[model samples]
Target: MALSARELWRILEPVHGMIYFVPEAQERFAALGLDRMAGYFASRAAALGPVSGEVVVATFYNFNPVIVHAAVPAAWSVTTPAALVEARYEAVGAALRRGLGELADDVSELAGLVRGAAERACEVPQGRPLFAAHAALAWPEDPLLVLWHGQTLLREFRGDGHVAALLLEGLSGIEALVVHAASGEVSAEALRRSRGWSEAEWADAVEGLRSRGVLDAEGGLSEAGLAVRARVEGLTDSAAEVAYAGLGEGERERFVELARPLSRAVVASGMLPFAKR
Candidate 1:
């Protein structure tokens, strides 16, 4: 698609949330199967680096620390029925319980690791705090399901300056930027009416988003951008396992690195998204 100048600029610019969901996120759900969880993790690791993986795992443990932590040691158990997998599960559980305990007590340290990792790997912009965007794209009505979700993501970062409106301009017809506003799904028509812009003016706005790299003709986010947005959110979701316990520096960094390649593999194969895949 022939993007306008604004569009091109938007595409080139750093989006606050594009670098999410990477390959390594799968480990966050190694036992249950990655599904959307895998792709989401990969995207984050790619953008934020491999360290965030710990954050993701911490979240995972919070949700069901007992179960997820147990998955590992179970494989090495020595008892008749429990020796193989059950023992191994217990071993893994013991280690996680301790890791989670220490992190639950330290906030500054965890924030420091997040800050350093955010700055180092994500190349965070000058100001503001950027947490992963939290949203549920699709879900199953079935109550039996208790595994990963199939929701791709877009993060919200601290841009150097105001860019949401600019992003709208850049997407234009080339890329229809979509945001679930309070009213409903915000789309081009909605922007046109609310902004009171002529077709030319709207096109101009979209052009801007494209240039910033927030909007692209192929899709809203570029490959790397999508990776970042997805990765951050994925980690956040993975962290659910651990809940308030959060993550420490070492563990968070470790996860980000390990999940990188696996996330890529799932996305590349088109099996990351639960429903479509």
Candidate 2:
């Protein structure tokens, strides 16, 4: 099948999420002395540099600024950027090594393909802030580590663009969550708790979306809602296209072919919570 940007995104999502959302990965970070929120700060800050709480909030998109600020100390106080970079590389490498093991052999097996994709992705001049920062970072020498980093950069590239699309569409955070939920990207309750919105606040946002004809009474997206969602996705894909534009004729397909097995190994290892779609 010819992959649309959305389909390509699905292939990449779990691979990227494994580093941050996997139970074992979280536990490993905890072992390294980072709590849930702190782990988020440490990883993101390391990649984004010693940025302020507000910048993190803007780049992260969905979470409340206050909530993001609470996690900022994990990055600023505990480790310098250089140290955190090394630490993040170590942590992610450990998780993937444990998860992929013999199935992936060594970093050598995947390094060139990852490097090609990343180098191509970096060629895109215009990018949202988070993706831009990550793309500017030096690639790691360990092939496995570089593979993870490359995927992270690509994921953030899409994410930053998606956030811009949502904003351009005039969707508030809760409303954005409502649309995402209605489309089944994430559960509404999970998004609410993750974003630190109160239950009443979430309900009000749902009602607001319904009032706007973006959602129906049962909290599903109506036709208008679906159209709006599709526009957001289309805009996101458009913004994200520059990164992939550098790929040579067949390279996108080749990159996907090379990446799929490694990604699947990570998923099958039960390291990430992403349900196969």
TM-scores for every candidate against the unseen true structure? 0.21, 0.88
Q: Model 2 misses residue 133 by how many Å?
A: 1.4
**On a 0 to 1 TM-score scale, where does candidate 1 land against the true structure?**
0.21
Model 1 RMSD in Å is 18.8
Query: What is the RMSD, in Å, between candidate 2 and the native fold over all Cα?
Result: 2.5
Question: lDDT tens digits, residues 1-277, model 1?
Answer: 2222222122212211112222222333333333343333333322222333344334221112232233322321211211212222332233222323332232333234233333332332332112232211122222111001111111223221123322323322223323111113345565454323466755665566456665467435555445544453344333222211233544544434432332333333443232122
Candidate 1 lDDT score relative to the true structure: 0.31
Query: Which candidate leads the pack in lDDT?
Result: 2
